[model samples]
Structures are given as structure tokens and as C-alpha cells.
Target: MRSTIVRIMRIAGLAAVVGAAVVAAQQAPPALVSEQELLDGLKADGSRWLTFGGDYANQRHSPLTSITPANVNRLVPQWTFQTGTLGNFETTPLLRDNVLYVTGPQNVAWAIDARTGRQIWRYRRELPPNLTACCGLVNRGFGVLGDKLFMTTLDAHLLALDMKTGAIAWDVTLEDYTRGYASTLAPLVVKGKVIVGVAGGEFGIRGFLDAYDAQTGKRAWRFHTIPGPGEPGHNTWSGDSWERGGAGLWVTGAYDPELNLLYYGTGNPGPDYHSDSREGDNLYSCSLVAIDADTGKIRWHYQFTPHDVHDWDATEVPVLADLAINGQPRKVVMFANRNGFYYTLDRTNGKLILAKPFVVTTWARQIDSDGRPHLEPNQMPDEKGEITCPDITGGTNFWPPTYDPSSHLFFVNAREVCAMFYAWKPEYKEGERFTGGAAQRVTGSNQKAIGALRAIDPVTGERRWQFEYLSPSTAGLLSTASGLIFSGDADGNLLALDSRSGTLLWRYQMGATMHGTSPITYMLDGRQHVLVPAGTTLTAWAIPAP
Candidate 1:
């Protein structure tokens, strides 16, 4: 009887071990992210948000309709995750496999559980003491592929981290941070290559965009925003001016798969606001360039605000779409420029289809037929100062705008403010602020600064409707298929607006403002969730389970 009992016990132990192994295998993730998955963009199931702009088109529009305008007011906070760091979030978080990969200020990142808002892994970089990050010590977000996440550092380096464990897979330096070069843009992954741009436009550093091998961290090609000696646009800048021209690209751009081109808007020239400092149009600066993704060659470019002196950097996001203009199907790129112009251009050859003022543009009344601005008299700034309508921040800044393809409406948070701009000759000093100008906000009884969330008809350059704010808001925007637009006021109020009519539907005081980040939505556990990053905390909201 004892021998028989021992035999049965051994068999039971073996069966238990085998059953545990089977369960583990079943629970494993499907596989690392595939190329086709990235190309698929946002799906109907709402399973992931794999790219920065939700897709290559840079349209922050989601297809999920569970959280409709009628039901969005019913959302309740599921969980809140705090950064516990110094600065605020300027990132667009990426979601995959029920996990959120987010990058925050001061080079800190986290992988959190989508279900519970729990941190699964955290990654932080030890930055140097004298870092010269001009804008803020912030990281936009990560670019993911296979098993790794790619991020640009404030110390001018690019790193690939293991998505599962947040371990550094590879690290490569883009430039010396001490020379006033820093990178804060999110990496954009396209076809086995990671593309990123350096930021130091205000510090007298020449700008360039780089492509690196995603697997090995090897640089594939470099495209200088400022043309070189033999380059085509080299003559656009005066002698030796192109060496330190500031066409830095700190904002993420859109990509077209069929054209195999990357569209990026460059920054203002160095010594900003002083026209004589760079005597020419400053080729590629304050312009949009269509670049060959495979060869890093410039295919075409359209300069908006050529030789801009109002500190207008064309770093605003470029959105792509296919529109039927005048009964002709046209593939076009739309841009609301900081120089106070809204433009529609042929994405194929960079030809202007239509250009009009979306705000109070005093510098120019309109864009001429040949795509040049019809400049107004005495608008340029000098030592005595000149009052410009859109101010130095322009009508809209670097914060993103959204596009709804179904409704054919483009939305942006616009500021209506004027500024007195003053400019003088500046001396060049490496690793120091190089702007030779200043802007003072115009304020008085009739000139109060105000903001509005405006829905624009891109085809006609007309305002469909606008929801006004008490103060000028710097927050980005997001839209959904269920007819909801998410935005934040300067006063820490998160708003849900009806996308069609711009009617206020719901408002919640988030306790902090979403500075330059837009809220993202996805479906989790059969409930649609809106993930918002405001101040230093990330909060997830969803409707109650039925």
C-alpha cells in the first residue's frame, strides 16, 4: 500500500508542473511589434496607439466611438500616475499589448499597466549638470519597434531601451550637448530606421535631421536643414551665414508611405528677429521640405515666411490628407503656419493650391499667386520696435492640431494676441542664447489676449466655428470619431467639445493644465478610456462597467 501511494504522489507532482507551464505559455504576448502593425495605424478594435501622431499622417484622431458626446460626461477617473519629477509632460504616450510607454520631463520614462495604472518598469537617465537644453528638459515620447523603444535625450543622445525591462539596448550620441545642441523630439521609426532632429535654434547651432539604424544604432544618413557648400539652397543664405543658420527641427513630422518622403517644417534662422544677420531667405528655414526617406535627399520645399524676422519657426505640425478640391481629387498637405497663414499645398511637388490668413495677420495681407506673401509696409521689427498682430507666439505654436477625415474639419487652439517686437544686431557666442530680439505682449482695454478652439475648413480657409477661452491656452488638441474634441484651457479645465458644432459638452478641473500635450484615447477591457497628461500626472478615465 505504501509503494502504491508513492507512485500516485509522483505522478500528481509531474502533472501540476506541466499544467503551470502550459498556463504561462498561454499568457505570453503574441509577438514583438511588426512592421505591418505600424503601417496598419489605428484599428477598429482600438487595440493600440503605436505612433506619435497615432499614425504617419499626424492626425491625432481616433476611430473609437464607445465614448460618444452624450456619454463622455459620465467618465470617471480610473487611476492617476504621477511623475514625481520637476518638469511637466510634453509627450504623446504609446500603447501596445495593454501597456503604456510614456516619456516625461527630465529624461524619465515608464511602462505602465493599462488596466491598473501600475508601473511595470521605469527608466531614467543621468544627465549632466551644465546641460544647455534651451526650451525645457523634456522628452517628447518614444518610437517603438520589435522589442525596443527609441528616445532622444536632452544631453544630445539617442537610446534604444528594451520595452520589456526598460534596459538600455543601445546608445549613440547625436551631438555635443555642451555646444548648445539638445534633442527633445520623439524618434520616428520608418522602415528599420529611426529618424530624429536636434534642437538649438536659439543657441546658434546649425540644424540637421539624422537617420539611424533601428537595430544597431548606426547612423544611416544626415540631412542638414541649412544647405552646405555645393547644395542647391546654399546661395539662399549670405556668406558664412548658413554655417550657423537656425533651421532646427524640434517638432515631429508626418510621413507618406507611397511617396517614400518625409515632411518636416524647419525653425527660424539664428539671431532671430534680425533680418540683416542672415541677409537672404535662409533656405529651408521657416519652410517645409519633402525629403526622400531612403536617401535623405530633398525632393521639394516650400518656404513660408521667407527671411522671417518675427521669430516664426515653421515647427508646427504638418498634417496630410486627400481632398476633392474643385471637383478634383488632390493629395495635399495642410499647414497653419506661425507666420499667421493657413496653407494647402500639393504634397507631390510642393505647389501652393491655396493660402489664406487664419488669424489677424498684420505683416502680410495675403499670399500672392506664386506662393509669396504680399508684405505690408513697415511691418518688420527694428530697435524702435514694431507691433505685429499675431505676436511672437503667432496664432498657433508648436502644440499639435487634429484632423477629422470623416468630417473634413481641422481643429487648432488659436491665440489672438499682438506683440511689440524689438530687434538689434547680436554677437555670436557658442552655447549661449542667440536671439537678437524681444517681444512684449500688447495689453490694454481693447487689446486683451484671448484664445479659441477653432474648427477650420482646410479647403476654403474659413472658420466653421470657434469656442472661446477666457485666457490664451497653449494646450494641444485631440478628436474622435464619435464627435468629441478634447482640449484644456489655460486655467486647468479639461473640456470635451462636440466636434461638429463646437458646443461644450463636459468640463472637469484636472487641477493642472496640459501644457503642450494632447490627450489620447483607446479601448481597455471593453471600455473606452481617455488617457490625459496634465501637469506632472497622468490620469486614466473610463465609464463604469455595465
Candidate 2:
């Protein structure tokens, strides 16, 4: 009888504890995300990483200095999280309050415990078998605001998922997949609206940037990259060329809150090499368009390639920076373009400040004072192939570069190579690739393609320093105030370098090259952890506790 009484008292005590926990949870207010928090970027507090570029400025510079060059070798792996999927990661993972929100290939997403590397919830999509997403069936990342997360799908849809649970709150179709539309961009959430762009320039689709109401999933506005009838630059394309003029804005762009403008770099025009199919300067394709954030209207645009026959998509990342030039502070946008050019433009109004070649560019001699490319004769693609410097991939591709505002330096992995390009008339089908040309890599014993990590002054468009690799690297970059810059080579090596001198400080073979992936840093358990997503695994490294 005494044993029974003791058991009843023990059960009652357990129930009371459980009930108290429930009451406490209900009374505590949920942590709400604020706009200022996003603007703060990667702070020394090391709490969260909410955006793709780490900030609206698209500066991937972190202020953490706990792990310096002197003790970087002492850092060891804390934990590893694997996707267990087939494809490698091209997406950047986001972190909040000890939980990681990540998007993977084929629209697989997860919210995982940052400390234990265990998944809290996972979201997998039922993708269409006949999906026409060009390049790859991959997602970039997620944008979170106020207990909700946003992601763009391979089937051209934007989905809002609950933060705590991976359940879909709402899904809105951006465009029909059958119409050759796909969205791989990480949605940019600004001013209570989610901003995104479609990727299908090679498939002969007209690309546009769309804004959706974050709460209701209702589309707020759409700004077509190509001008329609009666638009200012409509005549730039002859006849119906503008109908399928392929001005895709595939990559994520930078936002300037003070200017209320969102700047995005556009993709190559369709019939990619057939010059006659689209005549005159394809106004907006292969350009950077600054649009009003509130209303989807183009403020001004600067065309990188006036009438490009090469497949060099201006889809390379655009980084925004404020620089002082000749004793005057100027708001500028920096771009390391794929067409072998490094450009610095006045962001407020699209005006060319400086344009210089970072690689061997054979098609254009130079940019004229009036911002026109002086084309070289006999360089256009035809039935017989023509060799071009910097190849079809240009100097770089969509892999993001980094900027150090303190150093006034922009860092990019540039390719030094050439390719033989061939063109034929392409008959456009509903969901078929519409690129009229293809490029063959020019290679031999003596001829080789190589890559280098280049640091250029944003003000002068001149090389500050460079670190060469055996081959071109598609990896992205990260920098810190600790005088360190993290990068990866094509040979499966994660590298750390001095930010000012470009001297190698440390190296680790991650088994796979970063391959369009970047290393993100944060604080965990009182230690700073560097997280790298290479291949299918996320490896977290930290210094051993003293």
C-alpha cells in the first residue's frame, strides 16, 4: 500500500512539470524577424544568416575574428550533415536561432539542428518528370521573414513554408513549366514582398522579375526583362524577336534600401549565336537593370553586351559597394562579368564609371566613352567555328564573388581559356533548347585552361592581387575582418588567404570542390564554426575548447 501511494505521487509530479512547460511556452512571445536584423548582415553576435549575400549589399564579409590565421589549423570538425541525395549543393544554407534552413537539389529542403546536425523537418517536392529547368534542377536558397520561409522551385513556383514545421503554407505558380520557365534563384524578400526571377533564356522563354505578397501569396508586380510593344526599347529587337528575346535574370541581385532600387544582372539573348534572328542592340538582355523596389519599373539599365552573339550570360553576380573615388564618395555597383570584363557603374543612375577586361576578350576591342563595345570583325559565330578568348563561359559564370568594403577590393575567380563556337539556325519548340550555337573547348598539350582568384580594386578596375589554380574554380567566396578570405579550387581544396596580400594561409581538401558553394560562419556553443557545403555534405569546423 505504501509503494502504490509513492507511485501515484511520482506520476502527479511528472504531470505538473509537463503542464508548466506548456503554460510557459504559450506565454512567451515568438521571436519575430525585423528588417533591421536583415540589414545588420553577419554580425559579431553570430546569431543568424538570413540572406544569400549575407546582406542586402551582397557583401559576404563577416565581422567574426575568433578564428584567426594563427590558430586556423587548430580548428577541427564539430559535426557533419549530409543530404544523402545524388546531386551536389549549389545552394547556400541559412541559419536562425540554432536551426538551419537549407534547400537542396530537386527541391529538397530541411530545417536541421545546428548543434547536433539532426533534422527537425524535411520537405521534398514531387517534381515533374519532363521539367525543362535549364542548367540543373537545383534551388539557390531560402528567404525567411516572420516565421515563414520562401523558396523558388524547379517547376517555376514560389512556395511559402512554415518556419517551425516544413509544411507548405502557400504555393504560387510563377509560370508554366511547359512554357520553358524555371526558377532557381533564392527569393529576395524586401518591403513585405518576395522578389524572384525565372531562368530559361536558352529555352527561348521571355524572362521577367515577379514580386509576390509574402503573406497572401498574391503577385504584387511583374517587370518583363524584355520590352513589349510600345515600350521604349521594343524597336531594338526586329519584328517578333522581342516575343522570345530571352532576357533571363537567373541569379539573385543586390538591393539598396536607401535608393529603393533592386539591381539585377540579366542573361543572354535567345538564338544565342544567330545574329540575324535578333537585330539591333537587344536592349535589356546581357545588361543590369535597376528597378524600383515598390513598383516594378525599370529606373535605368546598362547593357553589357549590346548585340551579343556569344553565349556569355551577364548572369554573373552583381555586388553593391560604396566607394570613395578621387576624394568623393560614390555609390557604385561592381560586376565581374562573364564576358571577360570588370565593371563599376554608378548605382543610383546607370552610368558607366569604369570598364576594364579582366581576361582575354577577343570579340570587343574596348568599351567606348559612350559605353558601346567596339566589336572586332570576323568574331561572330557562324557555320564554321571561330575561336574566342575566355571561352563560352566567359571569365566567370554564376558563381558569386565577394567584396571587402574596408579594403575596397572585389574578389572573383576568373577563367583564362578559349573555345571554338559553332552556330546553326535553331527551330524553337515549346520546351526545347533554343540556343542556335554551341561551344567546344579548345585544348591541347601546349594550350590549357586555367583559373585564378583575382582581387581587383572596385574604384580603378585594376588587379590588386591574384592566386592562381591549376584549373578554373566555380566555387564562391567568403571574407572576414580577421584578415582572412575563404575560397576553393577545382581540385577539392578549401583555401584560406590573407585578405590584403592574397597569401595562402591554410588549406584543407574537402574531398570535393565547393562547386558554386560558399563557406558560412557563425557561433555555436561559445565557439565560432565555419560551415562548408561541398558535394553532398556540410562540414562544420571549430577550434577545440580550451
Candidate 3:
């Protein structure tokens, strides 16, 4: 009788302890994505991807070496998540705590379980019938902080969504979409602010950069690309042409925490090809601007094409790195511009270190000491027509490139083609096409449209090696510390190549081109997984579990 009574008392005590533990767990707050995590970027533990470029420097280089060139060929698709949407994907997916946050075309978003490729919640917006998203009906990606995920809409609004429930926390209008203002780039979150920009350069809209408080939807500051009445660059434009100068910011930029500055590439001026109306260098358009993150003050600017008339936006992505020049260490920003020139500039003061043509460019022979292009005569477009190499797409558009620090290589997909450009005086209409020129592909016995993945040395601005694609590939790139690169081609071949030699190591057909999208890698279930978004599908690949 004594033994039975002791056993019953012990069981009751254990039950009480178990119940208390459950209560405590239920009361605990959800894990917050701390500011430090954002700054840490892609950590070695492979826990999270908190930013678009995988880090503030826009390196897009992962340090995870779990899957290298040797085992890369063994990568098999674990599961595929379909978006079930019509348009192609251009957004980079953000991962945190085994969950994937994806933004699809048409302002659609999803929160998915990374382990199972299953959707937890979906959010869709009812947009206006007339969306003046000049480029495409797409979004770049989301920016996260605390418990909120931020995304830009096709109608020019920025939304803060609840990460767990996919519900709206706050909504803020960026600009009037009906008046030729739209946004498509990923929002860059830094310090305590979310930085973003407007898109619609071809529609005669003046562009600007903005920062908003992460907690509230209130804007912190706005930096106009085109200067106002008394500002210094206001005289660059002719007459009231400054109102619709069209230096849109459509691509994301790099940030320097040490300098507290943000670097962004601006777009082309309006009446794109006819230069009669807007004259005299056209101020900040076709240039890169460095701005103070807190105050939105312009620190320095470098114009790639002064008074650009060939429709080269200079809206390429800006990558920051600390490289050695001559014999001394220096900070630099490398850009492969749409004007068919590759440049390495001093990031600290926006001075040109080296500039060289990467393709068959007939517009300019070389860059002068003052960082101005030495123009080749008879290159400007007119009503009759003028033939130019690199065509209208310039060299490469908005596809994100990759920089491998170990190899010191800058990789990009370049087009080898030219076109006959035609120009006319375009009538301006609000929210309508305002470009005064169009490009016709030049196809002849000697002409061809070929693409190649070229590796250029940042120190010398010279070609190190190149891997040619059958056609011009629009895919972005991702590099790993294990000497592997992930890219897709125009023929829908997802590929893995040796970063050092550009040798093909592995390939898979994903049934769609990775147009304007790049793959991201992370650790899941003790193995590194490469997640790719192409067309309407999101496929996760990794080496088979042991």
C-alpha cells in the first residue's frame, strides 16, 4: 500500500510540470528578424537571406561550400512549387527560418514552407484596370524587418505584409501611377529605413529615390534625380524640360554601412532619341548618384553618357568592392552599363578609374580624362535611320550579375548584335509611350544574335574568359565560395559552371528562361539547396540525402 501511494504522487507532480511548460511556450513572442541579422547577410550557418543582393555590397556570392563542383552533378530536384500565374518571374525570393517569401507578377505573394515546397498563405491585390507599369507586370522581391515583409506593387504602392499571415500591415502610395510613375525594383532596407525608387523613364516621368520608416509607413526623405529650380544641375536641362526629364531608377543599388551612403544608377532622359528639346548634358540622367542614407543628400555623381541620345539608360546595377589598384588598396564600384561600356569607378568620390567597351559599340571610341565619352560622329538616330552596334538593349539590361571575390571576376551575359535606329518627334501624353525612337534588328549575311557569359577582371577592366551561349541569355547569376556559378540560358538550361575556368559542370532544363531572375542557395535539412524561380515554377534542388 505504501509503494502504490508514492507512485501516484510522483505521476501527479510530473503532469503539473508538463502543463506549465506548455503554457510558457504559448505565451512566448514570435521570433523577430533582428537588425543584426540583416547586416550579417548570408551567414555561414546558412540560416537566412535577409536582403536582395544576399548582402549590402550586392556581391551575390554565397559562402556555403556544402555543395561544390564535385557533387554539383548529383543535384536532383527535391520539389517544385508552381506560381500558377501567367507572367514570368523577375523577383528574388527571400528566405528566413525555413520559410520562403516570394513576390510574383501582378502584386501576388506567398509564404511557403521551405521543407515541403508548400504554401502557407497567399496574398493578392486588386489593381486598377489601367496600370502604367512601363516595363512589365512584375515585382523584383520583398524587404523584411521585424515581423513585416515589404513589397512594391504594380500600381506604385509599397506594402508591409505580415510575414506569418500574408496580411497587410500598412500600405503607402509611392507615386501616381496614372501619371506615368511605377516601381519594380526590390526595396533595400538599411539602418531603420526602407529605400526604393520610381520606374517609368520612357513615359516622361521624373524619377526619384525615397526612404520610409520600417515601423510606420511614413516616408523619411526623397531625393529627386532631376534637380529642382535653384539646385546646381537645374541648368543642365533646356527650359521646362526638367519636369519630365526621365532619369528613373529601375534597378537596385549597393549600400556602404561604413560610409552611410547609398549608390544607385539612374535612367535615360525623355524623348529618348531626339535631343533637340532636352540639351546640354541633361544633368543627373544617365549617371550614378551617391546619396547620404539619412538625409538624402547627393554626395557625388558620375555621368556615363552626357546628353545621351542612343537610349542607353545607364540603369545597370552598381556593385561595391574593395580592390587593389596600382599598388594601393582602394574602394571601387564596378558597372557594366547599357551603353556597351564596362567601368570601374572610385566608389568614394565617383571618379572613373577605367572604362572600356565590352561589345561592338560604335557610338563612342573611348572615355576621356574628365570621364566623358569621346563621341563618334554620325551615331545619333534620325528619321532616316542610323546603324549602331549593341542595338537598343545596349549590352545587358536589368539582369543581376555576380562578383566572386575569391576569383576576382565580374560575370555578365552580353549580347553581340546591332540594329538600325529610327527617330521622330514624339507627341507627349500623360502615362503614354514617350520614347521618340525605335530599334530594328539588323539581320544580314554577316549579322548574328549571339550571347556569351563573359568574365571580366575588375582591376584591369579586361576580359579574362567567356562561355558562349547559343542565344542571348537574360538569366542572372549566383556564385558560391566553392567555385561554382549558377545561371540559366535563353534555351531554359539551368547550368552550373566552374567559377575559375567557366567550364560547364552541370545542366538541367527548367522549361523556362530565368529571365531577370537569379537563384539563391540555403541550407535545409543539413544540405544546401539551390532555389530557382523560372516562369511559373519555383524548383528546389539539392544533392540526394545520404
Residues 287-317 of candidate 2 have per-residue lDDT tens digits of 9999999999999999999888888879988
Note the residue pairs that clash in candidate 2.
Answer: none
Question: Lowest lDDT 10-mer window, candidate 3?
Answer: 1-10
* RMSD after CA superposition, every candidate: 9.0, 7.9, 9.5
lDDT of 3: 0.86
Model 3 TM-score, all chains together: 0.94
Per-candidate TM equals 0.94, 0.94, 0.94
RMSD from true fold, candidate 3 = 9.5
lDDT value, residue 356 of candidate 2 = 93
Q: Taking the tens digit of each residue's C-alpha lDDT, what string does model 3 give over 1-546?
A: 001111101111222221122122222233688778888887544867888899988889999999999989988887777777668899999998888889888877777778877666677777899987776799889999999899888788898987777768899999999988988889999888989999988889999999999999899999999998999899999998889889999888889988888999999999788878888899799999999999999999999989988788877888888998999998999999888899999999998999998887898989999899999988889999999888888788789889998888999888888989988998889899889988888998898998988899998989988899998998999999999989999989999999999999999988899999999999988999999999878888888788
Candidate 1 lDDT over residue span 164-194, tens digit each: 7777889999998888899998888999899
How high is the CA lDDT of each candidate model?
0.87, 0.85, 0.86
- The deviation in Å at residue 307 for candidate 1 is 0.5
